[model samples]
Target chain A: MTYVVALDVGGTSMKGGLVTRTGEVTVLAGRPTGRENGPEAVVEAVRAYVGEIAGLGRSRYAGPPAGVGLAVPGIVTSATAVYSANIGWRDVPAEAFVPSGVPVRLGHDVRTGGLAESVFGAGRGVADFLFLPIGTGIAGAVVLRGEPYGGARGWGGEIGHAPVWPAGEKCACGQIGCLETYASASALARRFTARSGRTATAKEVVELAVAGDAAAAGVFGEAIEALAIALASYVLLLDPALIVLGGGLSEAGAALLDPLRERLAGRLTFQEPPPLRPAALGTRAGMLGAALLGWQAAGEHDVGADWPIDVLRGGSVS
Target chain B: MTYVVALDVGGTSMKGGLVTRTGEVTVLAGRPTGRENGPEAVVEAVRAYVGEIAGLGRSRYAGPPAGVGLAVPGIVTSATAVYSANIGWRDVPAEAFVPSGVPVRLGHDVRTGGLAESVFGAGRGVADFLFLPIGTGIAGAVVLRGEPYGGARGWGGEIGHAPVWPAGEKCACGQIGCLETYASASALARRFTARSGRTATAKEVVELAVAGDAAAAGVFGEAIEALAIALASYVLLLDPALIVLGGGLSEAGAALLDPLRERLAGRLTFQEPPPLRPAALGTRAGMLGAALLGWQAAGEHDVGADWPIDVLRGGSVS
Candidate 1:
């Protein structure tokens, strides 16, 4: 069977996979993003990664890889990387980086991850749901009627910048009291450092909170409250059936989810509260989603059926 | 040529109409909701209003009324009036009230108003937009891809209850600092009364602010700030192409729109701002939208063409 080359590009690393038509990750590989060198080096790194995957697909699969899919962070409008603070790139023609003559698909990393979750992960079987990744900054992927809604200008998922506290703190986006200022992983770490005068990663903060450290607990509590308010806002507007939490902060698991569910429940009065579930695929979701998009680009009609829920739940693809 | 019977049921009144297939309001009438009598009384009032319109349709139109459409306040699910605080209704089988032999369509008033705006009023020609009515309470109707989205349980559009200030005043919905508590017309009036010990309508408060009353200016300013925050949240989530404001508060017109637009501009950092415009149809939007829904129930295929923007702009049907 034919395969597709998929790449999930992050600031620090790139995950590459040769994905078969049956949703199997036939070959998986990785490489440093090399952004320390500069933007052009990052571009070259992405190109080489895709080349390696395509080579592996050509030798191992029934036919040459039919298409390539790339998932990049930041504002992606119609396949062009508009601007990505993570990659330090501006207006990059991303689709052109793939091998010539191969059909290619490009998408926002969080949105692509959301698509995978909606079809094959935690959000499986839900007609309407939201996928939120609380990493360096918070953004959401609104899945309505089985497709992601990009809004009028593809700026739909900037949930991080939504002002949760209008008079509270100034956000990096120049808005006051944005949800990301308190809820994102980076925000949790930053707030913990500011409060306790000890630098720690968000994971460390979660551990500290679990260990009953008052400072860490307070910081995490604030994050949970802000997330709850922002999510309540989303529920009122979209009425999603589920909210799938992914990204670095979600790695905190129950410590993050339990409080978030409680806070969200307390805030909603008339609206039905949706379940908050952890991302099952972790980092693999983006690459798998990119492969799905690639299959679509290659004119595969049964891509949805290819990645059945049963196979995903069994963890056979990863 | 067949006609449709339509009723826009409100807390205090029912606006009834016999509308032709071409968006023409052939006859219009009104009756007291008699809600103080009881929920059952209100139901009878709605039924009587529809019956009157059906009678008008039979005599005035070429053929008998082919269908009936009803728009009501509060949560609506599958043509069932689930709950309405305004009408004191719960699980009311609303379709049962319509005379047999006539096809019936039921929807939330705000959503049907949004539908009319999407096809014939301020939001015409847009694929996605939000319709918000700032009456006694704030609610939104999100129109996507030319149809109104009611969400999973038809409980979408309850934007009034979306918490804007976690530590602010309590709302009727039991939430604190909800957008409606600060931004809605009733909120403005009530807050003004509480602060100044003066009973005044929201319109009077707007007039006072315009005439340089410090207390009124402060209350109205808070309202504008709350509206901006709530709207920013909506923009970050749905990213509608336009936001059409209707109901009593919208009657303040430039007094309301000017400051709201300015405050919203300051909050959005990366997202392209959608235009905020006054609802073109005014109060008639609800009735006209009900009529449109009635036509759909009657099997009118060319309703979109019949509702060209020019006719709606002319205000002739009203």
Candidate 2:
């Protein structure tokens, strides 16, 4: 069976995968992006990883991979990685990531994960929704009419930076009252440390809050409130059918969803709140979405629609 | 020349017009909507106005009008007025407001105004922007990819109700810190009176603020701040190319736009704020948009693109 090489390039590491036309997935061990060495090193590392994955696909399937897809951070289009402050890359063309003859496509990192959710995860069968991943930083993928919309200049889903308090705490982005300042995973840990004078990861803080630690509870509660305020604005403005919550913090599950649902409902007076669901794909979303992009580059635009969720979730790791 | 009857139904009055296929417009005298009589009475009033305009078109052009288009408030689809709290109507079909077999279309009042702006007014040639009209109440038309978007259930574009402060003040809609509670035209007057123990229209309040009245300046400045906060969130979330301000309050011109531009810029830390422009069609946007809808119902979807701005601005009133 023919397959394609897919890579999800994060700031620290890169996850590579090969997927057949029928949705069989083979996930390879991830590699360091070598971003510490500089932007060119990161680009070379990505090319090496992609070639390695494509070589595996070729040996296994007796053919070169059909196409390559990479999900990269910062502002990106199908043809180029426009900019990424994290990796310090600018205008890196997609061709630089793969073999000369292989067709390749690129997508914005968060939006590619959102696209995977829309096609095969929580947002399946839903046309309009917001796919929000609250990781170290917060951003969203605005899915409209069955596709992710990046806005006029590819900066549309900066919901995390949209002010929740407008006059409250200063954010690292130099803004006041930004949702990310209170609600992102990094914010949770930082605020918890500030309040309790004890450092903890965001997951530990959530557990502490659930265990009834007052300081953790307060910090976590503010995060939820910030999320509610931001989401209330999102619902009023976009009126999406659903809100899919992903990212490391969403591991809190009902601890996050239950309070957020109640607070969001309380915030809105006239309209019903859209249901919020956990992201089904977890960290693999970007890789799977990259596979879809690869298939698109291979001229199989309709390949992923029929992939069973069970098979995708049951992907084998090599 | 064939024409169509176009009507804009407001809570207090109805504006009617006959628009030719080539964009010639003849506006009729306004009439009361008489919504105080009842929803059925209001529906009958619209039917009468539409029939009257069609008759005028028939007499002027020696043929029956081609179609009818009405812009009504609240939840609306092209074929139905699903709900309107202002008009107190529900599930009113488009045919109910027009003569038998004459093609008819309906649109949400605010979004219709935005449609006019998108096709022939301020938003012409822009694919994405926010068309906000701040009158006694506030609402917005989210124009995306050159069409007015009402969101998942037509409950979208309620930016007026989106909380700006999240804890500052109680809104009439029972929400806290609504943008409308501080920045709507009526809100400006009410807050000004509350602060000064004196009465003034929103326009007079703007004049007073410009003339250096401390109370008026404080109240108006708060209004501008509220608008800036709300609009900053809008820019962050959607990243529209432009923002078109309309309705009664926008007549304040530089008094509103100048400080608002500065404040909006201050609120944003990362991205450049989109340019803000006044609504070109003014109060006539709804009627002109209804005319475009009439043409759409008549199957001439491309009718409005070539209409000169001067011609649309200089329509003869009868």
Candidate 3:
């Protein structure tokens, strides 16, 4: 059976895998990106990771791998990695990183993860929805008619930069009161540190909030309020059936979801509030989505197909 | 040549017209809606206007009228006028008002007007754009890939309800600090009257601002600021190629466009500010858009076609 190489390239690490046509994934070794070295090193690391995954597929599968797919953060178009703040790359000819003669597909990491969720995770079978991953930074994927919506300039899902409070804090993006300034994981940690002079992860902040710390509660409350305002605007504009929250903060689970749902519902008067659910696939979604993209690029499988049938059959993948 | 009857139903009056296959439109007699007489009178007024326009088309055109199209306010879906605060309509079977033999099309006035602008006005040939008609209320139409984007629930462009000031005034929608409370034409007039204890139209408020009345300037300035905040969010999300402002306030022309452009540009940090243009088709856009829909329902014209080719030729349409 044919297999495909897939990679989810992040600033620090590259997650690689060899996925069979049947959606069975053989976990391949990861590599430190060494992006701190430079942008070229990052590209080289991605290429090397792809090579390792291909080797694993060739050793285990009946035939050579069909293609490769890469999911990267940034302003990605279909053919190019336009710009990525995380990777420190601009206009990178990312497809060239794949080995010669192998078809390659490139997509934004958030959108690719969204596609994975729409197929196999929380958003499964939902035609119109939003996938928001609030990690170090916030970004979103707008899934419409079961496909990611890339607006006119391929900037359809930059929901994090939306102004939630016009008079609020300044963002690194040079905007004031952006949703990212308050709701993103990095923002939560930074705000907590500034107020309490204690360096804590967003997870720790949530814990402190639950443990009855007033300062932590204040920071968390502000983040939730900003998220609710931004989401209210999205609900008015898109009216999606559901919103799936992923990324690091989402692991807080009900601590994050309950308040967000209540605040968002309160903000909406005539509009129906969309159901909010946590992403089920965790960090593996980007890799799975890359595998799906690889299958599509290889022309061996339809991306439109309800994929990972094994997962749908109530089976787990290890 | 076959013709279509189109009516733009407003709270106070109905603007009717007969449009030929060649895009030439003959203005038909208007009718008072007398909405104060109640919902039945509103529905009857719409039906009578449609019949009058159909009769006009039959007498003036070479063939009998082909179809009818009605543009109304409120939460309109593909088939039903789900709700209309302006006309006090709910789940109205709007298509039934047209004569049985004629095909009929129903659409929201804002979306229809936006379609008309996309085909023949300021947004002509622009694939992704926004049309905001800030009349009594401040709803918008998001035109993506040259068609109106009706979100999953057909509530795609309700920009007015977006919260601009979380601690600000209450809105009829039950949301506080909504953009409509400050920026809409009626809002400007109402705020001015409530403050100065004198009644004035939105147009008169603009005149006062231009004449250096500080209180009027304050109200208009607040409206401009609120509009800028909401538009910044839209730009961050959709990145439309252009933004077209229509309706009563747009008649203020440079007065509305100049400061709004400056404020919007100032608010955008990384994203390019879309060019803000006044709607060129004016009040007649709704009627023209209705005609296009009528032609489509009649199966005589492709709504997707670059229609009203004459308008593109720089010829006048009155």
By TM-score, the best candidate is 2
Specify the highest-lDDT model's number.
2
Residues A1-318, model 3: lDDT tens digits: 888888888778888877767777776556788889888888877887787668766777756679888888778875688888777888877576787788888888888888889877788889889999989888888888788776777767888999898888999898889999999999999999999999999999999998999889999999999999999999987788999999999999999999999999999987889999998778877888888888877986565245554432322323
TM-score, candidate 2, chain B alone: 0.98
Pairs in clash, predicted candidate 1: none
lDDT of 2 by residue, A26-71 (tens): 9888989999999999999999989888888888899999999899
lDDT of 2 at B58: 78
Task: Give the TM-score ranking, best first.
Answer: 2, 1, 3
Over B160-273, each residue of candidate 3 has an lDDT whose tens digit, in order, gives 999999878999888899999999999999999998888899999999998998778989999999999999989888888999999999999999899999999999977779
Candidate 1 regions exceeding 4 Å error are A34-44, A77-95, A305-318, B88-94, B308-318
TM score of chain A per candidate: 0.90, 0.97, 0.92
DockQ of each: 0.75, 0.82, 0.75
Look at candidate 2 and tell me the lDDT of residue B221: 96
Expressed as tens digits, the lDDT of each residue in B1-318 for candidate 2 is 999899999999999998888788887889999999999999999998888888887778988888888999989999999998888999999999998999999998999999999998999999999999999999999998888988888989999999998989999999999999999999999999999999999999999999999999999999999999999989888889999999899999999999999999998987799999999998889999999899889898898888877545445666
Off-target runs (Cα >4 Å) in candidate 2 are: none
